[model samples]
Target: MSLAPSSAPARMPGWLLILPALLFLVAFFVLPLIDNSLRSFEVGGEFSLGRYIQLLTDTFYLGVIVETVVLSTAVTVICALIGYPVAYYLVRHAGRWSGLIVFLLIAPLLTSIIMRTYGWQVLFARRGLVNTLLVQDLGILERPLQLLNTPGIAIAALVHVLVPFMVLSIATVLQGIDQRLEEGAQMLGASRWRTFLEVTLPLSADGIGTGAILVFMIANGSFVTLVLLGGGFQTLPLFIYQQFTTTRDFGMASTMSTILLVIAMTCLYLQLRLVRRAGV
Candidate 1:
């Protein structure tokens, strides 16, 4: 007996598949951004560039912008330097212990930021473990140093919090790299260090770029960490907070936000271009 031909189910269009997400983004993300951008340009119900002009001309705001860029750059560099070696080890040598190492790296991220920042406060307190070790056990100092509420400590905390992102980014890229490439380099009489510098390192540039972008963008917007540990160090985020809370100037705040967004987007574009070029 011949069976009737079965009909295939209708397939959904690609755009229809993503319609929900697109609608959600338009409602929440895009609309809010547009509103904020509009608010930034408005002056007494009329549109103007006064806010932008004022921010660009003002020395204090310019200084904050510079400081924010510098702080983020420093954090990104430190994360890259610290993460690359760990990532290399994790990819090439961790073997059976890789899961444990990854857990250790990600564990801190699972904790609340407030809790982590407070933990840093506890460690840097007058009689905290760090001070105790330096003053009592090691006798490195006569008195406990004022380690809390300092720029250096803030940077260290940022690095500690962000290094895992860098490590994971690099590790992912490293996993895709062929071991035989390195083997061939060494087989060609290249020293291990030379092979790493010439071959492995070049191959991992995309990861470094990705990690650097992540770290830089995050450090740019870090608020609580800087507020608790930065000792009055000003950045765009801090200034934005002040504009909202202290002065209640929504226009100025939105203007600064737009500027910060532009800076971040510029960096992202540049990094993506570099990664693409490297891939080529």
Candidate 2:
């Protein structure tokens, strides 16, 4: 053998390897957040809590906050309730109809949100299919009911858009669960419902928590859907937009943005804690 020393490739440190991503995060996300936080606190070249104080003290802003919370919670709950059964069916019966179901679930996401919302606009019109069916075909109503621009319609649109996320999340977790655990529970004289309650539900907590946090975060930040569906009913994001664009109040906009960020982070933290406590 030649007397050449064996050459080994040097391994990079983990931190060095991740430096680009860390730098990107700092440049884009972290720096923007810091800037916004500082801007929110800035008032007339001096630091103040006046923007936040106004947000908390004003009834209009408070109402928007409450509305945002309620809408987000309602959408999350509805998605969870509806998505579980669909996810379970997909996991348990993977061969038949699963592909079609998945296709339908993902099809809407591929389209533009504006186009989808406009489709809803068409359906919700006075002479739309819903009204046509109810009034002419079904004869359930003598006159077309005002269906558009209502809180109910807004919630429904949000649920339709977001439910797929919840379904996929839960289904992914459920697919990894061993079938023996569920069957064993059933064999122990437990009814199907009881077995599911005791065995299947507990293991799916992680997925549920993940989906809930995601849906809640997205719902709170909803702009286009709420504007198109709510029909003048304003939420926090709308409020922030108005502050920034219409009122040109940068301080208030930044403050509201920061508050929204806090709310999202707090909700995520609490959900993680709950999921951990549930042993998921």
As a whole number from 0 to 100, the lDDT of residue 220 in candidate 2 is: 88
Write the residue-wise lDDT of candidate 2 on 144-186 in tens digits.
9898898788788888888999999888889878989999998
Please give, for residues 1-280, the per-residue lDDT of candidate 1 as tens digits: 1121233234533446578999999999989988998899999999899988888889887888888999899999999999999999999999999999999999989988889889899999889999999999999999999989888889988898899999999998999899999999999999999999999999998999888998898889888888877666789888888887799888888988998888878888987787787674
What TM-score, to 2 decimals, does candidate 2 have? 0.88
Q: Write down the RMSD of candidate 2 (Cα, Å).
A: 4.3
lDDT, residue 136, candidate 2: 98
Best by lDDT: 1
**lDDT scores for all predictions?**
0.89, 0.86
Candidate 1 collision pairs: none
* All candidates: TM-score: 0.89, 0.88
